[model samples]
Structures are given as C-alpha cells and as structure tokens.
Target: MSEEILINSTPNETRVAMVENGMLQEVLIERNRKSSIVGNIYIGRVEKILPGLQAAFVNIGQSRAAFMHVTDVCSQEKLIRLEGQQAATQSDVSLPPISKMIHEGQRIIVQVYKDAIGSKGARVTCKLSIPSRFLVLLPDEPNVQTLSIR
Candidate 1:
C-alpha cells in the first residue's frame, strides 16, 4: 500500500507531499481559504429530480448544486441483483433508469466524483470509490478482480 503521511501545524495552512521511491513527486498546499470539494462525502438533500435527464440536482451545501446520475446511485449488489433478474450477461447489459431507483427530497450520502468545471456543477455518486496505491476499492463489490495491464 502507498501510505500517505500528512503533516499539519496550523488551521490556516496544510501541505500534502506524495513520496514515491523516497522522493517527493507531488506537493499540494491547501490554505484554509481555498479547497477542492472533490471526494467529500455529504449528507445532501435532493433538490430536484429530472426524469427526462435521468439525473437529480443535489444540495451538498455548496454554492452551486451537484449532479447525480441514476446509474451512479445503484450499489454493486443492486447491479448484480438486477443482472440476475435478466437473462443478459454483464457484458451485454445496461442498467435500468435512475428515476426508478431514487426520488426527490431524499437525504442520501453522496461523494463528489468530479470537481465543478466552469458553469457545471460537481458530479456526485452514491457509489463511493476509494483508491489506494495498489487498488481501487469498490465498497459494494463482493469479489476483487485483478487486471493485467499490457
């Protein structure tokens, strides 16, 4: 595992330096004033549901609303359960509509999947993905599959 050691002194400033092979490859400095919201978990309230787009605008206590897609809402177990119900294999199937899965005014735990770019809002997902040095952790996945990169 690639372990990260964070050194912090004051509430005003924080620095994150990524060490690889005993050498610093990346350094990030965060001031108390400016920070990115990506990967933040929020207990957001659903603001609006758009069936036409199969997405919802969520309030994650940010300046602009965040966007949550239906496909990103379902858990891995839910996907498997749905796949089992259909005769279609995993490679041949797509998920069902998001409208059937989530409703408006629901308080859901969502993680920021993407940062807000320009006028666009941050992309949020109910399915949380945790990444480490060696592996990308999917919380709902039962089995860990390894892929060989060519």
Candidate 2:
C-alpha cells in the first residue's frame, strides 16, 4: 500500500493525515502553534564534549543544545574503515571515545532523533534516515536489503 500526506488547514488549527490507499491511517493535529521537533536537521556547533558521558552538546540555534554521541558520529563506512585500520579499534566501534572523535567549536550536521523531555536536551544523531511509503533510504549505507511487508 502506498501512503501519502494530506494536510488540511483551518484558521485555528492544521491537521495532517497520513493516508494509505483511500483511508486515513493516522491523523496529526497541530493547533496553529505546536508541533513535534523530531527528524529536524540542523547545522550546529559543538558546545562542549563530555568524555565521561561519551556525548557532546551542540548549539542548534534552539533554546537547548542537542546531544550527540561518538558512536553516532561515524557512518557505517567509517566504522568499517576504523575496524580495518586496527585490530584494537574493532572492540571500540560500538562505544567509541567521544573526546577522540569530536571537539568543541566543531561544526556538524545533526538530526534530532528524540525531542527534549523535561530538563534533558534533544537526542541527536549524525545519521539521517528518509522514510518512504515502501522503504527507508539510508544514504550513507552501501548495502541495501529488501524487507518483506505484511
């Protein structure tokens, strides 16, 4: 089944419906004001690096800076390259040292994976995913596997 986004707007509110075939599968209502911030890409500057937490805070021109991890920094190819570079690097692929990967004042492109909840900042990732009706496209990944949909 193919899916499409149908946006309906009123003076007070805007409703977005995800339609599959001829029926509405999901409905998202935004009151002229509020919306979710997930999947937003921003060109951000690294504010601070916390080696203890294995993460970094990035200024994405928001009220709060986004958080990115070292594991999230390297692409799949980069991980493979690192593994091929040295035998010792293979074990560190999953949880790489953040300090060695990123530094303060570095500019990076980050996408919000999760929204800021309470006092915590947005969880960000360098990996970006584009979703389609039938498939999801990961630009950086080389291998493509077909998935069976039921």
Candidate 3:
C-alpha cells in the first residue's frame, strides 16, 4: 500500500491530510497564529515540584508551564526514542523520587512531546528527541546508545 499527501494552504492556515488507499489516515493543521509546539526544546526553570503528583511544572517561556512526571525523568532503560512515525511508550524503570531528583529553581532541558490542550498545559520529557524526516535524534540518550533510529 502506498500513501498520498494532500495539502490545502491559505494565508491564515494550512491543512495536511495523509491518504492511504484513498482513505484519510491523518490530518494536521497549522494556523498562522497558533502553530504546534510539539517537539520543541526549551531550557526552563523548575517553578514548582509536587510530590503528591509525582510531577514538576517548569516555566518554559510559554503561557502555561509544562508538566513532566517522574517517569519522564530520563532513566537508562525507560527512555522513549521515536523514529519515523512511532509512538512513545513507558516501561518499568526505577528511579529516585521527583523531589530528590529535581529541586525548585533548578534549570532543566526538556522537550515538549504534547501540546497544551483545553485548560491543561503541555507535557514534556527530559529525554530529548529531535525528529527529522527519517530519524529521531536522541541526543540525551546514554553515551553508549547516543543515537537511536526507529
């Protein structure tokens, strides 16, 4: 099976639809004013750490701070590396508590994997990944497995 892409562009917005066997498989839209921030990198200051939620909110120069859970803290075996069109998943990996791992006022490098939806902020991960046309560059992977291809 082969896929085709149809793009509809205008001054204010652009819509891209992927068609497989003439059936719409996926649709992505980018508005001029509101573009997606997924896959974007940011150096942010940890504004607050919630031990109860096992998460931290970092001010990444966005309207709302991004959210990161303890599991997304980038462990050796639990890291997610997506190449091509692969989806991310989580596995069992033990690590220290979020409170002990990250402190308030600490600066961390994070990558936004999800965009802000409704009233919630974007979700980020410390395991930085840069996706290109065919590869997802895992710059933060352990030195041994530095670069990962799908």
Candidate 4:
C-alpha cells in the first residue's frame, strides 16, 4: 500500500489532505478560529448514565454531550468480522454491565471517534486509537492488521 499527503497553508486556515493509491481519502482542516478535535483525548466527567440503553453521556468541554456505548466501555475478548474487514467488532461476549463499569458524576478519559453531526453529539470511546501514516492501530487489537500491502 502507498499513500501521499498534501498540505495547504494560508494565513487564516490550514488544510491537510491524505490521498491513498491516487484516491482521495481524508481531508483535515484547521482554521484560525477553531481546530479539529476529533481523536483528541479529554479528561471528562460522566454526565448521565442510562441503564436501559446501556450507554452514557459525557461532558468533554463540547457544546453537546458525547455518547459512550456499553461496548466501548468494556473490553471485548471475542472477535467478530465487520462488513469490510475482520476487525474486532463487539460481540455477545457477556461483558460486565455498564452500571458496574462506570457511574454518573465520575471522571474518566475518553477519545472522540466521530465528529458531531447536525443535532447529534459526537461519539466517544474509552478505548482510544491514534492512526499513523501507514497503519491503523487499535490498542486492544494488537494481533489484528486491517490493511495489506499490494
């Protein structure tokens, strides 16, 4: 696999484009006013916990509370196949209940996985992952490699 990076800088903004195999993949933009916060780690307080949905809402100094699902809270031992690749998707592996994992008003570190859309807040995960130039690394998935060189 091969990749190329294109960066454009101006006085007001800086844009970084990543092209893989001559195809446009991702573009990151940073403006003078606001910077992109996706993939940023934050020490946040757990705002609310919903036992019914097995999820929680956390305040990470964002406009809206980010979401934390049960699967993201607990580490899974079993591995499942995703639509695209054999990455570890959450399975019915009998993980501990969310209530046992965390509580409201508690503080924990979380990472933003998805950006906030329209009226919805961002999606966060306790299991953080930072991508490198040629590798998509998951902390828990040490033995799993999602990409292959052609």
Candidate 5:
C-alpha cells in the first residue's frame, strides 16, 4: 500500500488531497478570506446565559457569539478555571448549571471546535486541548499525558 499527500496553494485558496494506492481518500480546501476556526483559542467574554438551553453565548471577538454548553464548561476530565478566578469545585457525580458556572460579562478561555454555519454561531468549549507530534497538552491541567500511536 502506498499513500501520498498533495497540496496546492494559491493566493486566495489552498487545497489538500490524500491518495492511497492511486485512489483518492480525502480532500480539504481552505479559503484565505474565510478560513476555518475549528481549533482556534480565544479569551472571550460571556455575553449571555440561557438556563433553559443549559448553554451560554460567548463573545470571542467574532461577528457572531459562540455557543457553549454546560457539559463543555464543566468537564470531568478537565476542570475549566475562569480568568483571575479559582478553579471550580466539581465532583464525579454531576455538573452544575450553566448559570452557576458562568455569568454575564465574565472572561473565560475557550477553544472553537466547530465553524459557524449560516444562522448558527460557532461551537466552543472550555475543555481546551492542544495536540502536538507526541503528546496532547491540556492547559490548566496538572497531569501530563502522552499520545500512543500503534
């Protein structure tokens, strides 16, 4: 089996393709003007809280406010600490409400996991993870984890 990656870049657009045994496997295209923000991090302000939806709208300096859920705000694996605030006290049982976790006009760190659609805003999470060549770095996390590639 043979695999090859092809990348084509121009002024406005960039294209990437993966081929395996002369068969096209995947293709990705990105625009310079409208680039994807799937893995970007930002220090955003909490704009609004929707207790009914268990979500909050965060202003990440984008045109549209990003949406975040309670689960994202309180992750059992990673605890999210607000800017200049102490870490949240959580248990293994359950999570608290979004309103209790965050309030309006509060600054928090978030990472974009989904791009903005036509009407919906971008999806963000407080559980931030940065992947590198050999390990995944978790900010504000005390434990260090390494990647295993088998």
Candidate 6:
C-alpha cells in the first residue's frame, strides 16, 4: 500500500488531497475569504447558561455565541473515571449541572468541534486536543499513547 499527499495553492485558495494506492481518499480546501474554524481554539466568555437544555452559550468574539453542552464541559478526569465504571453504573455517576459548573461572565478556553450552520453559532468543547505533523497532544491528560502509529 502507498500513501501520498498532494497540495495545491493559489492566491485566494489552497487545497490538499490525500491519496492511497493511486486513489483519492479525501480533499480539503481552504479559501482566504472564508476560512474554517473546526480546530481553532479560543478563550470564550460565558454568556448564558440554560438549565433546561443543560447547555451554555459562550461568546468567542464571533457574530454569534457558541453553544457548549454539559457533556462537553466536563473535564478529562471525570471522563476517564466514568470509563472505568460499568455500563450500568455510568448513569449513577452523572455529571453536575451546567449552571453549577460555570456561571455568567466567566472565561473559559474551548476548541471548535463543529462549524456554524444557518442562524446557529459554532459548537465548542473543553476537551481540546491539538494536532501536529507527528502527534496529537492532549493537555493535562494522562501520559499514555492510546493510538498505534502506522
């Protein structure tokens, strides 16, 4: 099996193509006018907390505020602890309410997981993972490699 990456750049746009065994696998394009924020990180301020929906709206200096659910607000430590428990016991160890975790006018760092669509703003998560050429760094996480290099 053979794998290769092809990149093309123009004044206004740039494209990247991934190939495997002479077949195109994926293509990613970025334009100067409209750039993507799927992996970008930002220091957002908590705008509002909706206890009914168990989510919060955060302002990251964009036109609209980003939405973050309680599931995304939990720390990596809590997730790891939950993973160790049995499936039946998982429900018993539910996360605290979003309002209890965060309040209005508080600053938090988040990473964009989903882009905005229509009138909605982008979706963000607190469990950030930075990707580089060689590895994905998980900050404040346990020192263990969970993935095998090809």
- Candidate 3: count the clashes: 0
Ranking by lDDT: 6, 5, 2, 3, 4, 1
Residue-wise C-alpha lDDT for candidate 6, range 1-150, written one tens digit per residue = 999999999999999999999988778888898667899999999999999999999999999999999989976466557557544454566677899889999999999999888899999998889976557998856676766545
Candidate 4 residue-wise lDDT, 86-145, digit = tens: 444445445566888899999998999888888888899988787875787677664776
lDDT of 1 by residue, 36-68 (tens): 788888999999889889899999998889999
Give candidate 1's error at residue 148 in angstroms.
8.3
lDDT of each: 0.79, 0.82, 0.81, 0.81, 0.85, 0.87
Regions of model 1 farther than 4 Å from truth: 1-34, 75-77, 86-88, 133-135, 146-150
- Which model scores highest in lDDT? 6
lDDT of 6: 0.87
Winning candidate number (TM-score) = 6
User: Looking at model 3, which ten-residue stretch has the lowest summed lDDT?
Assistant: 78-87
Model 6: how large is the Cα RMSD against the reference? 4.7
- Higher-ranked by lDDT: 1 or 2: 2
What stretches of model 6 exceed 4 Å from their correct place? 1-6, 10-13, 16-33, 79-92
Model 2 residue runs over 4 Å out of place are 1-33, 75-77, 85-94
Alpha-carbon TM-score of each model against the true structure: 0.68, 0.72, 0.66, 0.64, 0.69, 0.73
User: Which residue pairs collide, candidate 5?
Assistant: none
Ranking 2 against 6 by lDDT, winner: 6
Candidate order, TM-score descending: 6, 2, 5, 1, 3, 4
Query: Each candidate's root-mean-square deviation in Å?
Result: 5.1, 4.3, 8.3, 6.9, 6.5, 4.7
What lDDT is obtained when candidate 1 is compared to the true structure?
A: 0.79
Candidate number that wins on TM-score, 2 or 5: 2
TM-score of model 4 relative to the true fold? 0.64
